[model samples]
Target: MFGGGGGGGRKPLDYEELNENVKKVQYAVRGELYLRASELQKEGKKIIFTNVGNPHALGQKPLTFPRQVVALCQAPFLLDDPNVGLIFPADAIARAKHYLAMAPGGLGAYSDSRGIPGIRKEVAEFIERRDGYPSDPELIYLTDGASKGVMQMLNTIIRNERDGILVPVPQYPLYSAAISLFGGSLVPYYLEEEANWGLDFVNLRQTVASARSKGITVRAMVIINPGNPTGQCLSEGNIKELLKFCFHENLVLLADEVYQQNIYQDERPFISARKVLFDMGPPMSREVQLVSFHTVSKGYWGECGQRGGYFEMTNLPPKTVDEIYKVASIALSPNVPGQIFMGLMVNPPKPGDISYLKFSAESKSILESLRRRARLMTDGFNSCRNVVCNFTEGAMYSFPQIRLPPKAIDAAKRAGKAADVFYCLKLLEATGISTVPGSGFGQKEGVFHLRTTILPAEEDMPAIMTSFKKFNDTFMDQYDGYSRIIQYYITPSVKT
Candidate 1:
């Protein structure tokens, strides 16, 4: 006897075909790092997180005015309460009204596709003062953070299969991920590691030419000043030459200046590409289109959770500017609180303001501490026998070139792994220090390196370094076979 429903007519759903685009992308490193960290936690190990540049996780605190503004913005009704006003700084209240007035739709309503005009104007002023050039407010588009601005810029230019973007081989993975996710070709250029991780113009020319020859329309070149994972800040001459190259090649310039405030060396002050472009005078034509990005996530703020940032597109055609706005419009607007935070960030307390003295002192103290941390970490790394670290001239990372023993290299090969990655994994296992391998950021074919944040608390750094050195020596001794192979690989490649 057949049941009431004799047969089922429905077919199984194929979830595989639902997201073919997502399937094409792989963020394996991040996933693996997370999984490994979780496993170690379960084992009751103390894990040192250095894989990402997050300061708050490392004990760096935020400043006053910004947080106060955040509290007000989060609870707007506070604006009406006299008690609330007393609790809040007068400057904070004034700033809120200024933001509301400048807000495209008065903070209560939706803003323009670009952003609130007043904030943009403040951003413009900030740019002018920082870059030493005149900036147009209309060209600025505030976003959730530099990441959104970057993705939008990438989306705007990456039209079809033929379009491509030139990015440094050892780059912030965001560029590679965005280009791939958007279905655009990625043209890789090598950074000269031997010469302090400098940009190689020859490699840039060769990469662009190769892409163009292959029918790929090279659209833009990305320059991460105070580079991520590498920590090399470009010189003024380098910036000028790069700008010239961009103009000659007819490519849009994408300057990731998020770490603009993190420079440690006096020689390498964060030089604005806007300044370089404008300073070139009439021959430079001011016609070269450029997009400069900034974020509150870096510098002294460390408000990564807030995700407040903006990007300015200078010297672009009016039509292109509108197109960018249209794209941003689709996302409605960045978080409202984030927008207010960004406004305060760019136009922070000035002298004579009630909170100026306290705010300025607190901000400077935070920066001073970071400076100390950077120096301490760099000095400690350099003291190790087998690790060679570049100066932490700018940015908060120290990318050290580690000399692995022959045994370790052989063990890694036997286990079928990149030597640096193998070393990092073992380091993580032995001690809870988490770091990203150079391979993840694209190193030279044979050289092995690792990127670690110099952000652990100052007092704990010495102990961390000691633990790292001990682990390296033990790992090398344990893997003698791998060390031999690594030596052979390096011998021929070694210069001098």
Candidate 2:
């Protein structure tokens, strides 16, 4: 033993030595339940993961053209193989070669700290096509995923515990996790679930004022347009109002628009915060800083493993942008294949191009499947006793509110668990259905909900729904003693 001088008897790193901020972080999507599920899977149980918006995990196939190009780039020698044309289309081969030229040394090499300039340009072009406005490639940062960019932005904004972010209740846990990790406060604003999960400005104002009253300096607000957990897209009018709120309050707007291409409702099409801000012109555009995040993970591409995403900074100070780049530099570069994937995602084949037909067909098929799954899951959940789910207008989740029996709540308490977590664990155990509890995402006190992705294959949904309904019914039956109490609370008897 070296005593206090060296290694022999020194204690290993543990919770006490960990960062306090790290200790506060809890991401329930892959928390205890998911870990248990994984353990069960290793034991050969067929667990269906509905906990996260991971499409490919649920059998969503990647698009042909992107994969082909990626494959060719990964093995550029494939282009020289005489059978290349036999396996890959002409356009894919050409695209791969093009990206190779763009990359400093193809997939093996690191790109510019910001990203490949050409790829960023393509991203900018994609934005211009989407918004009818110009985008600067220089303002873009290629990230491992949209989440990295979001966390980086939070890092720049949060200086201490006094700093807070205005985060929506029933939001994706990423925002909350990042705020915790950054040692910042999450000033909660409850979204109106009764009103199709609408953002109530009155609630926002009150939340901001209350946080301010408590000396929490609210510096940023996050909007997951085509929302996560709650899959309702923001109307243009609503977006305009939100922009106004940010402008008046001097809060930065963080737009999570990764689901921009996942819109299913014709009436509720996706709109970028940048587009709205620019349309408002000058003061609105100049004053309010907006950072919008997009990814190749959630769209029809469903290339979650690629880890490709970008965040465009609007109205941010040039100096701040430089800081972001400097931070990115420490990471060396975003994944090169991911950067190429981003390019493919933003600039798919044109109509006249050879791969156009296949690309369009593949993209359309995936979108249609997702739309069908969303509708099917929403209907099934709404039909369940004491459960209400709004139809998903966009994004890939159905966050259904469950009315837990008081008996069930008591049972959960006895188990030292939240009621929704108790319900989700039961569902998982009974039917191999994994889900994230609303407590993890934040919900009104006394309200119980669970978020399930609509990413399961269409063919598998009917059986999944049947299993879910049966488990729910059986669980409710077990808690029948509290059913009458819930009924009484909702509808009191009138004495004549």
Which residues of candidate 1, in runs, are more than 4 Å off? 1-15, 18-21, 103-109, 481-496
Tens-place lDDT per residue, model 2, 51-108, is: 9888888898889999999999999988999999999999999999999999858899
lDDT of 1 by residue, 196-282 (tens): 778778878988988999999999999999888788899999999999999999999999999988888887788988898888976
Cand. 2 Cα-lDDT? 0.89
Model 2 quality (TM-score): 0.96
Question: How far off is model 2, as Cα RMSD?
Answer: 3.2
- Report the number of the highest-TM-score candidate: 2
* lDDT, residue 87, candidate 1: 92
